[model samples]
Target: MEVMQYAEDALTINLGNEVDEKINRQLVILKAAIEKLEIEGITDIVLSYTSLIVYFDVQKTNIEKLKESLSTLDLSDLTDSTYSYKVIKIPVCYGGKFGPDLDSFKADGLEPEDVIARHSEKEYLVYMLGFMPGFPFLGGLDESLYKARLDSPRTKIPAGSVGIGGQQTGMYPFDSPGGWNLLGRTPIPLYDSSRESAILYEAGDRIIYTSIDEDEYYRIQEAYEKGQYTVDIEYRGEENGA
Candidate 1:
């Protein structure tokens, strides 16, 4: 691992240059260790696919002090899977208007069902949540389903729109301009400012997508709006031996 001054009030600790499970797990460990210290002036620890940015306040702590604190941390056994994760099952309705670019898979000799089957067949690791509020950057897209992004990006991608951009796949939590090819959409709200818990999933979590028909999509959407929908989740906590 390598550490460098990111800015006047931030530092970046790089775990690895490439994106891998071990690197991401190490990032989790590094962030947890920093938080455990509860050091003064550390305002926020922003994690990404390969590194973490520690934001600090000069009033409480200086760059030199924060760097010294980080040096004393125990970042050993980074490859050890000491952290736990919860699997969130998201229901999606693929193809048609929900995924106008669903046909883009055909260029790779894949049907929309083929794309759905491959895309939803595995659990995706939540690398980081960025690009927009509550928008998760998920890893583990099947190589066969990879497709280049659209030449002309859309100005307003619909909320809940699941899309694939180059090597990554994610959903839009709001109507935002994006270039990812739409694959489908989920009915559940990923981000709701009015809710007590704004975002349901975090960086360390894993999520699986299951194909749902249009009818079930509307049903779940309505249920969520009426405060009746609950996402299916399975926890594998380390402390509880789950």
Candidate 2:
């Protein structure tokens, strides 16, 4: 790991240069370790694909002291520790009105059912939440279903609209302009301003998709609007790997 001064009161820890599970695992462990320190000056810890930025209060801690403390952390201690991960199951309705871009894949000789099956079969990892609040940058999409983003981005994509851009797939948490190819939409709200914590998923969490018909989608959507639907989530203990 390499450490560098990022800002007047922040330090960037470079765990690796690639976006691999091993590097992410190390970043998560390190972030957890640092938080456990309850480091007096630490204001926030931001994690990325392969690095972490630790912000501190200059008045309470100095760069040298923070570096000294971090240097002593043993990464091996977390080898046996199991991180409890939430497996979020998102319900989606592919094709038709929900996914106008269904023909885009069909042009490539892919059946609509094949597209849905390919997209939902695997559990994807949440690399980070960015671009928009509660918008999860998920990894692990099937390469066969990969498609490029729209040359012209949409002026406004509805909330819960699931889309594929390049090799990645994600859902828009709110109404916003986006360039991703819309495949379908989910009924669950990824971000709710009324909640104490607005965002749903966080980095290191895993997400899985469940196929739903139009009827089921509307049912879930109505229930969610009425605050009666509970999102299906499972605790996949410890390690994120299968």
Candidate 3:
């Protein structure tokens, strides 16, 4: 890990340029260390694919004090929690009305069958939730499916639109313009601020996409709207305490 001081008010810890399970493990440990401090001045701990940016209050926590506090943390002793995380199986309908970029994917040598097969073959990790609320930034996309974003972003990408951009894939929680290649969508609501826990998924959870046909899509959509869909989940606990 490389630490860079910025503006004497924030600390950006760079976890290097690669994405791996180790980095994810470190994030969980580092976050616990920060939370242990119970520092009154810390504003937020923003996590990205390979970095943790900690914002601090200048009036309460100075750069030296923050750095010293961080130094006392023994990262070697830090470990993930033993609590189990549920593996959610999300049903999605690829192509057709759900995916606007179906033609473009076909143009890029990706048939609908191939897309669904590759997409559903792997279990993705929710590396970090960002860009949109409850919108998980998933990793482990098959390299073959990697494609760049559109030259021109759409004026409006409907909520639940699942898209792929380069090596990453995510769903649009709400209607918004984006350049990621649309592959399909799910009926599940990614973000709902009204509920006690509005976000459906969180970091450290495992996600699996189950392919469904267009008819099933509508069926699921109707059920979801009527609060009839029951999200299926499986849990796997971590070995060590958080």
The candidate that achieves the highest TM-score relative to the unseen native structure: 1
Model 1, poorest ten-residue lDDT window? Answer: 233-242
Stretches of candidate 1 off by over 4 Å are 77-81, 238-242
Please report how far candidate 1 places residue 233 from its true position, in Å: 2.0
* Ranking 1 against 3 by TM-score, winner: 1
Instruction: Report clash pairs, candidate 2.
Output: 83-238
Error of 2 at 142 (Å): 0.8
- Tell me model 3's lDDT, rounded to 2 decimals: 0.80
Models 1 onward score TM values of 0.93, 0.92, 0.85
Worst 10 residues of 2 by lDDT: 233-242
* Candidate 2 per-residue C-alpha lDDT over 1-242 given as tens digits, one digit per residue, 9 for 90 to 100: 79999589899998788888777777777888898888789999888888899999999999999999898887766655777667889999988888888768878889888899999857999887788778888899998888999999999988999999998899999999999999899988889887555776788888998888899999999998898998877876766233
Clashing pairs in 3: 81-242
Ranking by TM-score: 1, 2, 3
Q: Write the per-residue lDDT of candidate 1 for residues 98-215, one digit (tens) a residue.
A: 9999987787899888899999958998999998888999999998877788899999999999989888899999999999999999998889877776887878789899999999
Ranking by lDDT: 1, 2, 3
Model 2: CA > 4 A from native: 239-242
> Which digits, one per residue and each the tens of the lDDT, describe model 3 over residues 1-242?
57788766889988767777667757756776788788778998877777888899998878888887787776666664453466888888888778877667677687878888998847898888887677778888988788899999999998988889888888899998899989899887777676566876776678888888888988988997887887777878776443
The segments of candidate 3 whose C-alpha lies over 4 angstroms from its true place after superposition are 7-9, 79-84, 240-242
